[model samples]
Target: MRSALMLGSATLCAAISPAAFADDVLDNPFFKDSSTQVMARNFYLNRDFHNNGPNTQSYREEWAQGFIATFTSGFTPGTLGLGIDAIGLYGMKLDSSSDRIGTGLLPSSGRHTPGVDKAEDDYSRVAAAVKLKLSKTVLKYGEMTLNLPVYSTGDSRLLPETTEGFYLSSNEIDNLRIDVAHLTSLSTYAQSGHNAGGMTRADVYGATYNFTPALTGALYASDVEDLWKKKYAGLSWVKPIDDTQAFSADFRFYNQKSTGAERGGDIDSNSFSFKTAYSYGAHKLTLAYQAITGKGGYVFYTDGGNTNYLANYVQYAEFTREDERSWQARYDFNFAGLGVPGLNVFARYLRGDNITLANGSTGQTEWERDLEAAYTVQSGPLKDLTFRVRQATYRNSFSGDLDDVRFITQYPINL
Candidate 1:
C-alpha cells in the first residue's frame, strides 16, 4: 500500500531469509548458497457485521495455525546457471463452528453448517519452480509468487497465493528493471488446489527506473485473456530534511478497458491517487487523495490475486466506484524513537463520496477507520518473534457495516 510498484519484494509462498547451508554442501556453488526456512504463524479473526443481508450470517470468526517451509538453491557455476526453489504450506483449523466460519484462514465452502462439506480440519500444498540465471537476468518456470502491481499475489492471510508459468526479471541496465511474465494458473489461500481459481492465461509486463538516489518511477501493464486490459504508471520521490526528518510523495495512475469476451461487463475507467508524507523524529503524518472516473469502477483481476496500488485501497473497502473520490489521513509512531526498540503503532481514517450507483444515483458515501499495534522480541530466546493486533470499522450509506479485529503471531526458524 505504501508504493504503487513493489519492486524487489520476495516471492514468498510464505517466504524469507539467509542461505544457511549444511557442512557437506558448502563447497558447491549451488549448495553453498542454498538455504531453508520455516515460518510458523498463528492467526485469529473476528468480524461483526452491524447490517447484514437477509438470510446471511451476521459475523465470521475463526482461529488457525499455519506453517510455511521454503527452500532455495544457489545457481550452478556456469554461463547459464541453473537452480530450483520449493515451498510447502500447511494450515490447521483450531477453532470454528457452524455459526462462525469463512475466516479465510482455512479452506471452506457451502452453507454455514457443521458438515463434512463445509470446513476441513487441515490442508497442505506444495509447489516448486525451476530457474536459470544468465548474467544479471533470471528466467523462472513453474509455480512462484508474484508481487507486481499488475499481478501481485496476495499474502494477507495464513498463507500466500501462487501462480504458474514463465517469469523473467532483468536488471541488466543500470538503475532499471524489466519484468515479464506469462501466468497460466493461480492458487488462492482459501482454496485447496493449485488451480482452484480456474486456469486463465495472462501476459504481464513491467519496467522500473530509478531516476535519482531518492526518486523512482515505474510502469506496468497486463492482458487477462477475455477479461480486461490494464495499464499503470507511478512515481515516488523522497527527500531528507536532516538526520531525523524526511518527506515523501507518491503518485499512481491506472487505466482499464474491457477486452475480448468482456467477462467483467462494460468497463472503461481511469483511476489516480496522490499521497504525501512527512516524518520528524518519531512521528509521521500522511495524507492522500484518490479518484476514479468512468462508466464503472476500476476493474482488475481479483481472482488472480491482482492488487490495486491506489492510496485509498483500505482494509475493508476499496473506495473505488463509478466517479468515486476518497481521501485518507494517517499517523504513525515508532516506539523505537520513543526509547522502545521493537514497538510501533499506526492509525488511519478514510472517507469516500461522489459514488455513482448502477441505477445512476449519486452522492452515497462510505468510511473506514483502522488501528494497529505491533511488537517484536528484540533480545530473548525467541528473538525476532512478532505479535500484532489490528482493528477496523467500516460503514457505508448503501451497504453492510462491519467491525473487524485480528490477532497474529509469527515466528521464523532457520535451518
Candidate 2:
C-alpha cells in the first residue's frame, strides 16, 4: 500500500508544471498586489554541562540579534504572470568570548573545521527569486525556503538556512497539491566556521492530499546526491468533538538508504512515529511513540541547526538511534480559559531505551524533560509582540548531562 501511494505521488509530481508564456515575459507587471514584511528577532542561548568533557565546551553562551526582511510582488496581469521575491538577512553578535563560543549564535573562525571557539563579528547575505505563474501552478528559480516533508530548511537560529534551487508547485487539482524541486547548493545561516562554503545538491518530489476539512495525507521522496535517499509519508487528522473539545492524530514514517557512491558512509534505516492528542477548553494532553529499526541510526542533513518532523524531536534529544524505542507524555494549558489571555504553557517528558551502539551494546537508555512558557501581546502598542522561555534537562548513558535554557523575543513589522 505504501509503495503504491508513493508511486502515485511521484507520477502526479512528474505530470505537474507551469504553463508556458505566449507573449513577451516583460509584459508582466512589476508590482500589482505586492506586500512587504520585516521581522526583528532577539535570541539568547545558554547551556551548562554537568560532566565536562575535554573536547567539548562545558559552558556555552551567546547573544545575537537578527533582521529578516522579505518583499514579494504579485504576478503581473496576464495569461503568464511574472513576479519577483527578495529577502535580506543579517545577524549581529551581541556578546561572545573565545572560551564561551560554540553556541551557534555567531560564526566561528575555522575554515575547514566547523567550530565555535573563535567567534566572528557579524555576517549578512541577500537572496532573490524569479517566479512565473500560470493558472494555479507556479515555477520559481533562485534561493528559496523549503518546507517539504522530506527536505526542509531549518530556521531555529539567528538566521534560516537557505538554498539555491528551482521549484515547481501546483494547486490546480481540487484538494490536492504537488511540489517538485531540484536544489544545487545550500548556504548555512552561520556566518563563520561551519556555514562558510559548503554547498550540496539534492532533489525532492512530494504531494499532499486533503481528504477532508480535518484530514490530510502526504508522501515525499528525496535524494541528496551521493549521500542518502529518503522516503517519507505522513497522515494528520483533526476531529472536533464539540465547540471546545477536539481530538487529533499524527503519524509519520521514514525509510532511508545510501545511494550512488555513498559519500556520507553506509546508511540503512527505517523510522516510524505516532502522536495522539486531546484538547478540552484550555487543557490539552498528548501521547507520542517513536521507534527506529535498522543497522544505522536515523540521520538527516543539518549543519548543527536544523529540525526534523519526527515526533520526539525535542529541544535536547532527538531520541533517534539504531534499534531504539521511545515514548512521550505531555500536557498544555492556555491562560485564556482562566481569564488571562495570550498566555500558554506546556511540559513534556520523553524516555528512550534499547539503544544499539556501534560497540554492540543494546541496553543504553536516555531521557529528557522540557518546559516552556510563552505569551503574546493582546493589544496596545506592543500588539503582536511575543516572548518565550524554554528550559530542558537531558541525560543519557552515552554522553554528559545538560541543562539548557533559551529566551526569545520576536516582533513583526509590515510596510
Candidate 3:
C-alpha cells in the first residue's frame, strides 16, 4: 500500500502539464482558483460474538486505522470551465486475530486461519475526477460519491465508496433541481479493491420541486444493469409550531424489479416508509413505520451476494424486510440550547416481525436497540471536528444471534 501511494503521488505530479500552470489566464480569477485540502481519520471496532443463526456463535475482536487525502483544483479560465479532483486512501490493520477476523472494515482474502491469529496487513486505492461547469449546471466524470436515495454511494467503513461514472446536475429552474448520472464501475468504502465483475453500468435520474418554503417533493428512477431497477417518490413537509418547536413529516414509496444479468428469476417488490417528528425546547421525538409488500423482499446491491440489505436506508431502529413490517421510536436531545454547544445524544428502538426468509422459512421476528452520543469542537483549531460513539444489540426469534459495538471520530475541513 505504501508503494502504491508513492506511485500514485508521483503520477499525479507528472500529470500536471506545464500549460496548466500558467497564471492570470482567466477573466474571473475566482473561477480559476486552486487549493488543496487534507483530512485524516482513525477508526476502531470490536465485537464479542457473531451469531449467524439460532444458538450459533462466532466470537472475535479486531481494530484498524485508516487515512484519506484529497485535492481539488478550480477550473481554468475559458468559456467552458474545467476542473479536476483527486482522492487517495489507505488502511492498515492495527490489531486483530484470525478467529475474530472479517469485519468488512478491511480487505480479507483466502481462507481464515484456524485457532487465533492476525488477518491481512493493509489495502489502498487512488481515484480522480474531472468537472465542467456552464451557467447553472455542472458535468462531472471519474470517481464519484453519489448521495441519492435510489443509488446512494456507501460510506460505512474505512473510506467513502466511489464509483467510476459521469454525472450531471442542473439548477436552472426556480426552486427546482435535476440530476442525471451514469456509473460504469464501483469501489467499496474500504478502498480495499474494486468490483470489476459485478454490474458495472447504471443510469439514474431524479428531480426535486420545492412547492413552498416548508414543503418539498422528489421523484427518482434508476436502471442498474445486472441488478435491480428501482423507482422512488417522496414528500417532506415541516411546520413550525412555535419559535423553538416544529413538526416534520416524511413519506417515501419504492417500486423495484430485476433486470438483465441480475434477474433473480422474477421479482416484484414495494416498500413504504413514513416518519413524523416533533420538537420541544432541546428535545426531539420521532416515530417511524416501514413496511414491505411484494412477492419476495426489498432489493439492494451487495458485492458478496448477501441478501440482508441493512445499509443507510435501513436505520438502526428499523430495517426493510421481505414481506415484513417494522416500526421505530427515537428520541434526541441537543445540548447547544442548554449552554453546552456541539453536544447531542440519541437513542432508538426498532422491532420487526413476520419476515419470510429466502429458503421458504416463515414466522420470523427481530428487534434491535441503538444508543449514540456525539460532540463537536465549537471554537479553536479543531473547530468542526466531531466525535461519535454508538452501540447496538439485535435479537431475533428465528434469525439467530447478533450483537455489535462501534466507535468512530472524524474531522472535516472545508476549503
Candidate 4:
C-alpha cells in the first residue's frame, strides 16, 4: 500500500459523494473509527564475550532510541469494506562506536554483518497496506507482519521485520480460522530494503481450530521458492483445577525438506517439542523438552525474520543441531501477590547435548541461564511506562561463552 494511493482514494471517495449527493465517506465509519498509536522505546544491549580473538570483536554494545507509530482505519460500511493500515519506524543512535557495534540496536555498516564495526547514526522506514473485507474474510496487499508456526517475522530488535505480499484471513467457520499468504520479499529489522536473499516467492497456509474454550489445535505449512518446504503442527490444552490453579500442556512439531535446487542446501530435519506448565495464584512453573533428528539442524532465513518457534530457541542459543536434544526448566513469580503490582520476575535454564561439532566431533554440549525482571508504572503521568532488564550466561564449546545483559524501557501513547 502506498500513502499516495490512500490519499488519492480518499479524494476520489469525497468527490464521488458530493455533500449534496450523499454522506462523505471520510465522515463515515471508515475515518470515524480509525485509531492511531505510537510507542517510544529506549534500549541498551551489552554482551561480553568470554573469549575474544583477532577475527572476533571482544563485545558488542549499543544504546538506541526508537519510535514506532501505527495507524489503522476502520472498514467502510458496505458489503465489501475497504480500509488501510500504516506503520512508521524511526531509530536513533544514543551511543554507538565502531569498536562496539554488532548489537542489532543499530544497523551495521554491512547490514548486520559481524566485524564490519560501523553503525548508522539513524534510520527511518515506513510501510502501508490496503485491505478489503467481505463477510468474515479479509484480504490485504502490501507490507505486513506475519506470525505462523511455519513462517514468522522477528520483532526482538529495534524494529520488526516485515514482508511485502498478499495476505488473506477467513473466519467463516464458527470455531476455526484460516490464513494464507503469498510473499515476494522481506525487510529485516536492521535493513530498510526488501531485497532479502533473492526471495522469489514464499507461499504459506495455516488453519487453527478451537475444540473448546480450553483446547486448541493448529496446522501450518510454508514453501520458500527453490529452498525448502516446512510443515508445523501444534496442540494446546489447559485444565483449571481451582480458582487460582491450573495446568497446561503444549506440543509442537516441525518437518522440513529441501525442494527445487535446494538453494538452502539439502535440509531434512524433524523437530518436536513438548512443554507443560503449572500455575498457582501468583507463581508459575514450566518445563520443556525439544529434540531434532535427521540430516542437519533447523534452517531459516537468518537475515530476514528467522525466529524459530522451537521451545529451546532462547535469548542467546537455539539448541538445534543434528540429533540434538535439549530441556528447559523455568519459574516465574508475580509481585502483585506480595503487594507490589505490575512487577514480575522469571528465571530459566536450558541444556542441550548429543551434538556433533564441525569437525565431526561427538558428544558436544551447551547450556544457558537467564534471569529477567520487569515492572510497569501503575498510575500518575507515567502510568503504563514499563522497564525491563535481562541477564544471560551462555556456554558452548562450539559457539564460545558470553554474558549478555539488556535494559529496555517502553511507553505507549494512544491517539
Stretches of candidate 3 off by over 4 Å are 1-35, 50-57, 111-118, 263-266, 303-318, 413-415
lDDT head-to-head 3 vs 4, winner: 4
Question: lDDT for each of the candidates?
Answer: 0.87, 0.84, 0.74, 0.87
For candidate 4, lDDT tens digit of each residue in 103-163? 8788877545555558998988899999999999999999978788877888778887888
Model 2 weakest lDDT span, ten residues long: 17-26
**How many Å off is the CA of 401 in candidate 1?**
0.4
RMSD (Å) per prediction: 11.3, 13.1, 8.9, 7.1
Which segments of model 2 are wrong by more than 4 Å? Answer: 1-30, 111-117, 192-199, 303-307
Candidate 1 lDDT over 168-253, as tens digits, reads 99999999999999999889876669777654888999999999999999999998877788899999999999999999999999
Report the C-alpha lDDT of model 3 over 1-415, residue by residue, as the tens digit. Answer: 9999999988887776444554335434434476655555667776555446454336655677777777777776667778888888888888777667766676655644424334678888888889998877889999866777677766666677777789999999999999999888777644456763265788989999999999999998888877778888889999999898999999888888877775544568888888899999899999988888886667664422221222214323336667888888899999999899999999988888888878878778888888889998999999988888888787887644556777777776666
Please state the error at residue 371 of candidate 3 in Å: 0.2
lDDT of 2 at 196: 43
* Higher-scoring candidate on lDDT, 1 or 3: 1
Clashes per candidate, residues 3 or more apart or on different chains = 1, 2, 2, 0
Better of 2 and 3 by lDDT: 2
